[model samples]
Structure formats: C-alpha cells, structure tokens
Target: MTDAPALFLGQSDQPETLLLSRANRHGVVAGATGTGKTVTLQIMAQGFSEAGVPVFCADVKGDLSGICMPGSPNEKLLARAQEMGLALTPKAAPTVFWDLYGQKGHPIHTTVSEVGPVLLARMLNLNEVQEGVLSVVFHVADKEGLLLLDLDDLRSMLAYVGENAERIGREVGNVAPTSIAAIQRSILQLEQQGGAAFFGEPALRLEDMLRTSLDGRGQVNVLDATRLMNSPRLYAAFLLWLLSELFEQLPEVGDPDRPRLVFFFDEAHLLFTDAPDALREKVEQVVRLIRSKGVGVYFVTQNPADIPDSVLAQLGNRIQHALRAYTPSEQKGLKAASQSFRPNPAFDTAEAIQGLGVGEALVSTLDEKGAPRVVGRTKIRPPDSRLGPATDAERAQIMAASPVRGLYDTPVDRESAEEVLAARRGEADQAAADAKLAEARARADAAAAKEAEKAAAAREKEQVRLDREAERARAPARRSNRQTPVEALTKSVLRTAGSTLTRELLRGVLGGLKRR
Candidate 1:
C-alpha cells in the first residue's frame, strides 16, 4: 500500500496521497479566501502534470499563471517541506495559457452550435418561454443547414426567428416575439460584458487541452479569467460547455490508470447559482457520467453548500480548508462542512475544521480500492511552481512558445447563419424592389397607352373633318358646274351636227379630185 504510485497531497501521520488510479472519481477543494486553496490546486495540478495527466484550470485571480515558471525556494516552503519529511524540488509544469478574450493567452472559442441551446439559455438567464424560443432558433438553424458560428450568427438567427415567428414556430414550437426580444437583449448584455468574443472560429479543439510536452509532462492549460469573471454567467456557461464537449468527444475508457484530462473549476459556485433544477440535474449527471470517459472534474470553491448535494456526493476526494463561524449562517455552514467528512478517531473533526491554519486542510482521498479514506487533519504540501501571478514578460514568452501559437490567435468568420440570412434578406429586398419597379413600369405603360389612344382618337377626328371639308368643297364645284336639261340637249345636238358636216366635206373633196 505504501509503495503504490499516488499523488502526494499532504502528510497526516505520513504522506497522505491520492491514488492516481482513482483520481478520475472526481474531487473538491473548498476553503474561504486566503486559506491556501489555490496552492492546494497548484500542488494537485503539478502532481497530475508530473504523472503525465493533462490539466485544465481557470486562472481566476491570475495566480495560476505562475505554474508556467519554476518556483523559488523560500523559508516558508522549506519549512513545510522539512515538516512534511520530504525534499521539495522547485519545478515548473509545462503550461499553455488561454484567454477567452485572446488578450492574455491563446483565444479559446466555441461556436454557437457547440455551446448549444441549453447552456446558452442558462447563460442568457432566459426564462422558460425565452428558453423555448432559443431552442426553436437552434432548431430552425439546424433544419435550414445554417451554421451558427459566432454571436452575429446567433443574432441573425434570433432575428430570423422573430421575423418568421409564426412560420418557424409552427414548425418548431410556439415562439413569442417578446421571448425573442428578451433573448436578444440578453445576448446584447452578454456582448457588452465581453462574452461575445467566446463564440467564433477557429474553435478550441479538446485535444489541444489534452496535450503533453516533449518531456512527457502534462500541459497545464490556464485560462485567463480575469476579465471573464465579471460575467459570471458566461464563465459558468463556458466551463459547462467545455465539460459537455469533453463528455461528448472523449470515448469511454472505463477505469483507466489515469484520467485523460483533469479539469479544475474555480469559482464553482457560479455554476449552480440560480441554476434551474433541470440544469442542475444535468450537471450532476454529467459529473457522474464523465468519469467513465476518464476525465476528472475538481470543483474549487469557498463553501461546500455552493455545490448541489447530488454533485457534491459524487466527489470522492475532499480537501476542505478553514471556515469562519462568526455568524449564525456561517456556523450552520461550518457544521454542514464538518459533518460531510469521514471522521478520523484521532481528533475532533469539527474542532479541527475551525482550528485548521493556512496551508492546512482536512484531506481525504480514495484508496486504491476506490473507497474514501478516513478524513485526516493534514498539512498540505506547497506547490513546486511559483505561488503568485507570472510577470507579463513570462506570460508572453510562454504564449509565444506554445505549440498552438498560430492555431487560435486569429478568428475566422466563416459563412454562417448571419451571412446566409443577410443574403436571403438582400435577395428578398431585391425581389421586392424588382416587383415594385415592374408595377411602376406597368402603370407607366398603361398611362402611355391611354395617352396614345386619346391622340389617335383626336387624329381620327381631324382626318374625318378634313375629308368632310374636301367633300363639301367638291360638292360646291359639282353644283356650280351643273347645267340645265335644255343646255344639255343643245350641246348634244351641236356634237351630232359637227360629225355630219365633216363627213359631207370629205365626200365633196373626193368627187372633185376623181374628175380632174
């Protein structure tokens, strides 16, 4: 039992270690502020890395950045090492820094489709109706083969759904415009809080977080959450999304010798704060089921009560720091925390919980057989890495040396729902414009035809008038040239007499010529 390979957490009677094989059962580290919870986290992170198990943790206060740099020996660290009867060596874990905003580390992003509607509804603080509307939006996107890659895509989808609420609602569900508007306002609020940067491409690949360095040490991915902490909902939703992604992407390995990845969720209270019962249940379910995928989820928070009981029950390893019991509620919380631990007959667990000093915690971890050991009042080990924030220069150097340097630094805005809907809207607008133009042209043609017909009618009337005038002038000439019946008879008689006289002259001339 003593020779079993384990993560040396702290020393009670001897070295109290967490069995590496049982690490995927999940754990919790709870303490009030300045109770060395971060250091405990750092030590565990170091152990996991040294064991070649990759770790992902949020750098909530920027302190975890020091894991990138080697630690400096100090009197306090040396005293703790000597007290724990171990030689503490200063070493740094291979670390890769990440930031949601891309300012502090490599930008970590996930597409809207990746985040999905459930977490998004929680992120936007949507009510049931709004949640339903958001779900419908996602459904419509899927049905139309629209890729929702970024915030703009989501915005466009929401607008599209709003514009076609009746039609889409009939297909998906009943989508209320008010619900859509509320979701829209919620998205805008999230954007203002810097949540918009987290949705886009190229999205973070889960394999990147599981990478180990060339030296075989696990890569410690430290997400810079300094700015993200302001939007607690976004922070929670992002972490949940990551967990969901891991659960979905990683194949089940059963009980492996070590976890595929170990996740440290700091400020874990945000995950459950005002979370709906259904979401809480889903989270509890993920925590329970994800272990089968060989992933370990450790929740770091101030109070044990912050975690839902269902989730808290799944955590096998517990390192609880001191809790102050000045007020009644605090006393009640202290009682709850103290009662949660498996009692060690060596000391009063409740008294020990109150009296534990900084760097000391009540440690309990799963045995090699996958059962919780009796809780022990233990002095936690100091981190081999530096205990404070890294300098800007060091962070820059680490980021520059990252294997994924150019991978996610630049964002990609691929053709998504936003562009597609915009094109559709443009086409629709152009069609409307064309139709209007056609209608106007038809009206203009009709008016011109009407004017032409009037002109033609006027011209026909003028031609008729000229023909009548010509006929009238001819009629007067005909009347003036007209003769009486007697005149007509005299003319006829003269024409007959002329004919007879010509004939007689011709006959006389012929007779005279013949006689000569």
Candidate 2:
C-alpha cells in the first residue's frame, strides 16, 4: 500500500489520504461557512493537478483565484505541515480563469442548442406544461435546421412556434401560446439576470478546460462566480451544464487509474433548491452514470441534507467539517450526517463533528477495493496556493498569456434561428405583396377588356348609320318608291286609245281636202 497512488489529505492517527484510484467514484466536501471547505477543496484540486488530472471549480467567493498565485504561508501553516510530517511547497497550480460575463477571464459560452430544453427549462424555472412546450420548440428547431445560438434565436423561434402553433402542434404536440409566453417571460427574466451573455457562438470547448501543462501538470480551470452568485440558479445550472458536457463529450474509460477531470460544484444547494422532481432525477442520473466517463464530481455545500438522499448516496469520499446544531432541525441534520459515516469507535462521531475545530474534518474515502474506510478525526492539509483571491493585475497577466486567450474573448454572431426566422418572415411578406400586385393587375385587365368591348359596339353602330346614308345618296328621288302591277296596265291601255283617235281624225281631214 506504500507505493499505491493516493492524495495525502492530512494527519489522523495515521496518514489520511484519498486513493487516486477511486477518485472517479465521486466525493463531497460539506461544511458550514468558514469551516475550511474551500481550503480542503483547494488542497484536493492541487493534489489532482499534481497527478496530471485537470480540475474545474467555481470561484464563488473569489477566493479560489488564489490557486493561480503562490502562497505566502504564515508560520502557523508551516508548523502544521511540519507537525503532519511533511515538507510543504508554496507554489501555484497551473490555472486558467473563466467568466460567463467575459470580465474576469476567458468568456465561457455555450449555444442554446447545447443547453437543450431540459436544463434550459430548469434554468428558466418553467412548469411542466411550459417545459413540454419548450421541448416541442427544440424539436421544431431541430427539424427545421434552425441553429439556436443565443437569446435572440430562442426568442424568435418561440415567436415562430407561437404564430404557427396549430400547424406545428399537429406535427409535434400542443404548444400553448400562454405556455410559450410564460417561457418567454422566464427567458426575459434570465436575460435581465445577465444570462444573455452565456448562450452564443465561440462556445467553450471542453478540450481547453481538460488541457494539461506541457510539464504534465493538470490545468486548473477556475470560473469566477462571485457576481454570478447573485443569481444562484444561473451559477448552479452552469456548473451542472459543464458536468453534463464532460459526461457526454468524454468517452467511457471505465475506472481509469485516475480521473480524466475533477469537477468541484460549489454552492451545490442551488442546484436542488426548488428544482422539479424530473430535474432532480436528471441530476441524480448524471451523477450516477458520469463516473464511468472518468470524471469526478465533488459537491461543496454547507450541509449534507442540502443534497437529496438519492444524490448524496453516490458520493463515496466525504470530508465533513464542523456543523452547528443550535436548532432542533440542525441537530436532526447533524445526527443524520454523523450516522452516514462509518463509526470510528474512538469517540462519538456526532460529538466529534460538533467539537471539531477549524481545518479539522472527519475524513472517509474508498479503499483500494472501492469500500468506504472508517471515519477518522483528521486535520485537513493546507493549500500550497494563496488563501485568497488573486490580484486584478496578476489575473490580467495570466489571462493575457492564456492558451485560449483570443479564442472565446470576442462574441460571434453567425446565422442562426434569429436571422433564419427573420428572413423567412421577410420572404413571406414579399410574397404577399407580389400576390396583391398580381390581383390588382388582373382587375385592371378586366376593366380594360370591358371598355374595349363597348368601344367596338359603338363603332359597329356608327358604321350601320353611315351605310344607310350612303344608300340614300345612291338611290333616285321619287314621291313613291313602291310600284303596282294594276296601275302599270291601266296606263298602257290609255296610250293605245289615244293613238286610235288621232288616226281617225287624220283620215277625215285628208278626205275633205281631196273634195275641195
């Protein structure tokens, strides 16, 4: 057991240590405020980094930033290390600072698509119905190939789904406008709480956080969550998102010699506080199954009861600092916490929990065969890094020299749901306008055809009038233009009678002339 891989935690009756072989089994660091939980976390982080295991943790109080700076250990710290039979080195771990707002260090970003609907619904605090609607929205986005990169993309997508709810609902499921509006309001609230900066392009790449120094020291990725604590849900959701990312992106190694990465979830209660049952189950499931991926998750909270029993059962290694039990509820919690550990039989575990001084904890970790060792009253080791936040100038210098210095610092606005939906709407509008113009042209054509018909009819009528006047001009003038057959015969007989009378008169006149 002497040469076995392990992290020296501190001195108990014997040397207290956490076997690195079982580090992937997951653990917890629980204590009240100012009970050396941060220090314990720092020591564990440094230990893992030294083992070439990358670490990710939130800087809630801004104190974890000191891991990037060398410590100025006081005499007391040095004496404690010597008493523990160890020579201490005050050197900083290789650390890279991160911030969601992009003010502290490298900006940590993730697409809305990556956040997905479930975690997003939890983040937005949506009810069941609203969450279902959100799931439908995600489905539609996926089907339509819309990339939801940021808040605007999500907002526009919601509007699109809301406007086309019936059609979309028939294809998928019911997307209530009220539910959509509620989710929208929740998004607005999240945006107001500064969540807009988190969902965008140039998202955080897991490889960057999982990097190790060229010298084989693990890189410590510290997220500046001091201001983020103002919105506890955001802080919790982000860390959980990172954990989920690690679980999904990393292949299952099935209990590697050491964890590929170590995640320290600070202020863990916010993850479960008012969280829905489904969400809690999701968190529990992730914690349970993510160990096979060789990533260790350590929850840092004020009390063990803050974690649901289902989740609490999964944490094997426990470093519980002192917890006060002034109230009955507190005492009940204390009893429950103490009973969770294997009884040492040296002293009452419950009594030892309350009587423990600062930097003192009941250390229990899994043995080489993956079994919880008996609890030990132990003095936790001091961190080799500084005990407080790093100076602003020092942080700036580190960030300037960061490996991912320029990668995620600037924001990227590529084409996504926002622009896609907008262009679709614009096209729709142009189509409508063209249709109206076509209808107007059709009406105009009909009017022009009717006018042409009327003009043709008038011209035909005028031509008929002109033909009648030409017929009058070509005809001979007579009082009666019609002829009768009886009148024509009577006129012929009169002409014959008159010719006979003339012939008789001419004969009588010729006879008288001859007699004379």
Candidate 3:
C-alpha cells in the first residue's frame, strides 16, 4: 500500500482512503435527497482544498457556502472524528463565492461565442431546426468577425441574419425565418429566466478559479446556485462551459501527484436531462478526456442511473450513500448502483446501498495499481468546515476579500455585434435616403431644363415675327399698277425697236431691225 498524499474518506473494514495520485481519474457521490450527499460533497471539497487542490462546486441548496466558515462540531461529529483517529481541526477552506445573477456572490459572465451554438441552443431549449439556424447565425458572426458578447449582441445578430437570410443562406446554409423567430423567442424566454446576466464581457477567468491562497491552500470556488437552480439549463450550461474552458486552456499534465483542480457537479442529473445526443456525447467526451489535464470531476446526484453508463464508467472513486428502491425504476437504479462496485463477499452490495445510514456509505476507490478496490462499508468523516450556508455578512466579507473582486462586477458594453449591426442599419438607411434625394434632384433638374428650352423656343419665334413686321413697316409704298422688272425691260426694248424702225423707214429698215 502506498502512503502517498491522500484523503482519508472514512473508517471502514480498513481505512477508506482515496489516493491523491489517482484522484484525477474522476468520481461520483450518489444517494437519496437526505442521505448525506451534501455532507459527503462538503468533506471532499474541503479535503481537496486542504491538499492544495483548488475546488469548484455549485451551492445548489445554498448550504455549501458554509464551507467558507470554520466548523464547530457537535458531540456526534467529534465522536466520529475521534473514532477515525483524525484530528478535527476547526478550519475553513479559502472560498470565493460566485453567482450567475450577481446577487449572492460575484457575478459569473461568459460571451455568447464562448458558450457556442450547441450549448446556447440547449440553454434556449431550441429544436433541431432552430439549433441549426442558430449555428448558421454564429457562423456568420464568426465569418464577419463580429463579437457576440451579450444577449443583445446575439439578438441583433439574429435579426440581422433573419433580414438577410436569403443572402447569408447562400454562403452558409438555409436560415429559415421561422427558425430564426423561434430562436428569438427562446432567447427572450431565457432572458426572462435571468439567464441574460450570464452573457457579457469581463467573462470568467480560469485562473481566478485555480487560485491558491497565500498560505498555500487551494481556494474553494463556491458557485451560489440557489436561484440558478430555477433556470436549470442555464446552470448546467454554465458549468459545462467552465469545464470546457478548462479543458481547452489547460495544458496536458498527464497524471500528477494530485489533481490541479477538483470540480463537483451537484444536482448532476440536470446536465443530462433532456440533453441532445450531440451534447451528451460532448459531455461524455470531456469527462473522459479531462483527467489527463489533471482535473477531477465528481458528480453528485440522487442515483447512479442518473448518469450515462459511458460517463459512469470513467469514475474511479465512488461514494454511495443510502437509496430507496420502492418502484421498478428506482429498483433498477439500485441494482445498477450496486453493480458498479466490485463485489464484497462480506455483504450484498445492493442491500448495502439501501441500508446505508445518513453518515454511512459504501466507499470504493482506485487501488495503487489503478484498479478498483474491493468495496467497503464506511463511516464518513465529519467536515472541518461549517455544516450549513454562510451568513449574509460572512459572504459579504468573503466577496470583499476575493481575488477577482472588481474584475467582473461591472458589465462591459464595448462595440460588439449589436452596435456594429445597428451602425450598419443606420448607414443603409442613410444611403437609401441619399439615393432618394439624388433621384428627386435629377427629376427637378430635368423639369427645369425642359421649361428653359421651351422658353427659348418661344423667344426665338417672337423675334422672327417682330423682324418680319418691322421690315414690312419700313418698306416704301408702290403703285398698285406698277409694272414688273421683266415688263418694264420688254417695254423699253419695244420703244427702242419702234424708234429704230421709224428711223430705218426714213433711212434704212435693215439698221432698225439689227438694233432691236
């Protein structure tokens, strides 16, 4: 047996300890509603923190916030710790509270692009066709280099895509108006459900959740999810996004001495409930591969069957509290839960699961060789932290001392898709107006030119008429019987001929005829 750094889960046939080295392999905590699941999660979270591993978990019932305060164990808890040979030191994990609504703790924010279309569609409860249209919209935004930072940005982009559907459809795919409208309605519904606060600038930084205290203890990032539970999809989507962010950003670390971070997904059924196949496949993929990044994901749910078998198979450590098998479905759940653990000749695993008490559980963890250890019935360890939710004043003090105090408190509204699209619309309107004005000016100029041409023609015609009348008035008057030029010339010729003839008669008639 290796004496590596480990968490002493509880006292069992032997000590039930989870080797820190194999903690990255992932785990699960399953039980009924009041079967000590929350307490188990609390202990595991504080254990990871004390071991210098940062932890992130949702405070579903608001009670998990008590992890930020030191414990004051009663007689029963003290007796349990004493029985386990553990020194119950009253100390709290260094905790930072986070909230999606920015009410109970520091606000958590992420952009629309960060969430992506698949998860965003899931958040909006969109149908397949609507989801496809949303993907197209996101593709257009990305191709255009538009930032979808907030809900308003997404709304504007949706409207823009809808208006230019035919044009954008040719480039990407068909963006049906009905699908767009459906998605728009879904977004509006999401906004009404208080999901709008989660999408904006100053988004969550992974480093903030991965911080270690000045004293070398890991910070427990407690996400207050009391109200978030109302919007179950939003809560699930946000956590999934955070996990994805870690998976993408963190470098591969293989198996280290311990996990760099431990993430607890409480009310985990919400993650898989009504999840589409593509999204379910993605969740399984992330859960399967994220261990190599030195992160451990532990799911806390009411039943083991709440998790898919593919994902369930990846969990190396399992702490199962009591469960009820009244109905066939629940009986099946019980059977499945029991079958997950290696058989214990000491007792039937299924009956053991049902018989477990509030603080008692069946603990099974990976052995030194990375094999499943033989199941053991264990008495769970008492948390060194407080057992319930923190007071408002305590949460306030914690928030004030948080490392990321003012970083994401104020919402940022820089120029994004919304503003850019608005500007585009404004410019388009102005261009249309300018074109109309130009057309009007052209028509008016044509009318003016036609009128000027008609006026010039009228002036020219009047001038010709006046010139003709003046010429007539200025002319000298002639007798009505005045002979023409041809007539006068003929008369002169005749007179000359007559005179010549008279002269010729008197002298020579031949000379007069020659002169004529």
Best by lDDT: 3
Alpha-carbon deviation at 10 in model 3, angstroms? 1.5
- Cα lDDT of model 1 overall? 0.91
CA lDDT, candidate 2, residue 310? 99
lDDT of 2 by residue, 369-442 (tens): 89899999999888889999899999999998898889998889999999999999999999999999999999
Clashing pairs in 3: 504-508
**Tens digits of lDDT, candidate 1, 183-261:** 8899999899888899999999889999999889899999999999999999998999899999999999999988889
Q: What is the C-alpha RMSD of each candidate to the true structure, in Å?
A: 9.7, 6.6, 5.9
- TM for every model, in the order presented, reads 0.91, 0.89, 0.90
* Residue 184's lDDT in candidate 2: 90
Please give the range of 10 consecutive residues that has the lowest summed lDDT in model 2.
481-490
List the pairs of residues colliding in candidate 2: none
Number of clashes recorded per candidate? 0, 0, 1
Residue 222 of candidate 1: its Cα lDDT? 95
Evaluated with TM-score, which candidate comes out highest? 1
